[model samples]
Target chain A: DAGITQSPRYKITETGRQVTLMCHQTWSHSYMFWYRQDLGHGLRLIYYSAAADITDKGEVPDGYVVSRSKTENFPLTLESATRSQTSVYFCASSPVPYEQYFGPGTRLTVT
Target chain B: DQQVKQNSPSLSVQEGRISILNCDYTNSMFDYFLWYKKYPAEGPTFLISISSIKDKNEDGRFTVFLNKSAKHLSLHIVPSQPGDSAVYFCAASLKSGNTPLVFGKGTRLSVIA
Candidate 1:
């Protein structure tokens, strides 16, 4: 209730289908981020929001979209899912620029 | 290019022994470094952090040493226990900015009893 939480802990979708991963935080942190973890890549930032209605791309943002309509919600969308996009997605929130708290990641599989 | 790198994919150590996990960063702009521990099927949690100004920071049995000149850092867990077995990740961020953290691939540490 006081930390970040992600919806659809596990998801299986077909290629070319649209998918959205939801992230919510109760802390009302100013910064929220989305990252994907792969076997060799570790965790690469996809997108981040400094505050509501303001979003920016990170290291890898291709084929992915993110939006922060409210202080507590940041949702990531996959316009057209691909098999290569399968990975564990983590959402994190930070009150400041330094420390971040992560939610239980959502494992996504594209077939 | 990978700004942060963890050379070791996995490491094994005896219980009650020292466990050292190393990390290297190529970017000189990074001034803040952090270590995180992740369990299976869960997101990583922050363990410790050190700024570029300070070479060492300690918390409980976890200590992080930073070598700015070498662009390297290490996390030392003293008297490591089986419960400490997990994937450890190193991350870096700019000193004064909104830049997101760059993470290393992570090293899986196992403390055998």
Candidate 2:
């Protein structure tokens, strides 16, 4: 597809296990972001990448790690999942100052 | 502290009526604001945006008004339709580039026919 896509639309992992959510975009946007949406909190940015090999933390980056080895892929990893980390995760891509195009999202459940 | 805040948790509006959603921010450095709409199981989709330089920006039946002095902004939907019912989120950015957006809690809009 030409738009952004996320894999493992839904996931359930144990507390001590590591989980990774993948995001890929065909548009090759320069900017890619990861956000977690929870009740009472609309969307909190976890991490963002400006380009390949350039990534930075966002509002809520603790306990979550992100890396962008290529322009089309940005993956978020949870070293050790926690129950509080259960929330819907969204990936978005944008070109400079333009509006973002969001992926369908991945729902992660930490048990 | 939350830089962006949407006080209303939900709103009910009759079809063909105007739907107004308000947003407030504590950061004065924010220069751009945007509104996004999301369905039950989908990620938010960009609806409209307004820059700090302008007080208002309109597109079709949607209009966004920015009051920089008050650190407030609002999204107006005229003649709202049932299809417009969704969770709306307000976001702000310092400029662009590497500055990640700060989003407010979404407002669920229910447009009744």
Candidate 3:
């Protein structure tokens, strides 16, 4: 129970509504990432943070926003969620380079 | 353009046999390669990884072979078991530090009993 955790394992939202998926890690990893997994897209990164207050865009970052105000927390926000954004979102943290630890994942559905 | 590609979307292997999962990358700058396994509705967990400096890295029943020249890599699971059935993903990164990983579409591996 000491690794990473995601809130609301399952979520149902409506289009044009805003939703925030939370990711928290107890390991205090220096790096944190938000990735959305779709059928044929594998895991596409939405955003990543190097440390607190430092974030950058990834492959798909149009409607999504992420902030790392603390090293242990990285929350991804979907501003005005759309049906196309429905996917399983995963949060991962890494203290080093090669190995990454992931949260259970949050299944978000926009109808 | 997908930087990492997993041509085979799915692979079926019988129990007690070998399960080979292949991955390829278009970018030669990628220096680190890794494999992860994901169960339904769960996040992927790191399985094995091989750096560009090495061609092979082994851990228990999982072995990763890196062919730098071909820009290809493979993961081998020996004597596959039913529990090994999951979606296997291949990822790559440029180098150390905060570089995020580039993941392939993944291959659904079914190890039948």
* Single-chain TM-score of chain A, each candidate: 0.98, 0.97, 0.97
Cα error of candidate 2 at position A2, Å: 0.2
Top of the candidates by lDDT: 1
Ranking by lDDT: 1, 3, 2
Which ranges of candidate 1 are over 4 A from the true structure? none
In terms of DockQ, which candidate is strongest? 1
User: After superposing the true interface residues, what Cα RMSD does each candidate give?
Assistant: 1.2, 1.8, 1.4
lDDT by residue for model 3 over B54-92, one digit each (tens)?
Answer: 999999999999999999999999989999999999999
Instruction: Residues B5-112, candidate 1: write the lDDT tens digits.
Output: 999999999999999999999999998999999999998999999999999999999999999999999999998999999999999999597577889999999999
Q: What DockQ number belongs to candidate 2?
A: 0.64
Candidate numbers, best DockQ first, in rank order: 1, 3, 2
TM-score of 2: 0.97
lDDT tens per residue, model 3, A1-111: 689999989999999999999999999898899999999999999898888998989999999989888899999999999999999999999986456899999999999
> Per-residue alpha-carbon lDDT of model 2 for A46-87, expressed as tens digits?
998889999988888999999998999999999999999999
True contacts kept of each: 0.66, 0.59, 0.70
Please report, as a residue range, the 10-residue window in candidate 1 chain B with the lowest summed lDDT. B93-102
Model 1: CAPRI class: medium
In model 3, the clashing pairs are none
Highest TM-score against the true fold, candidate: 1
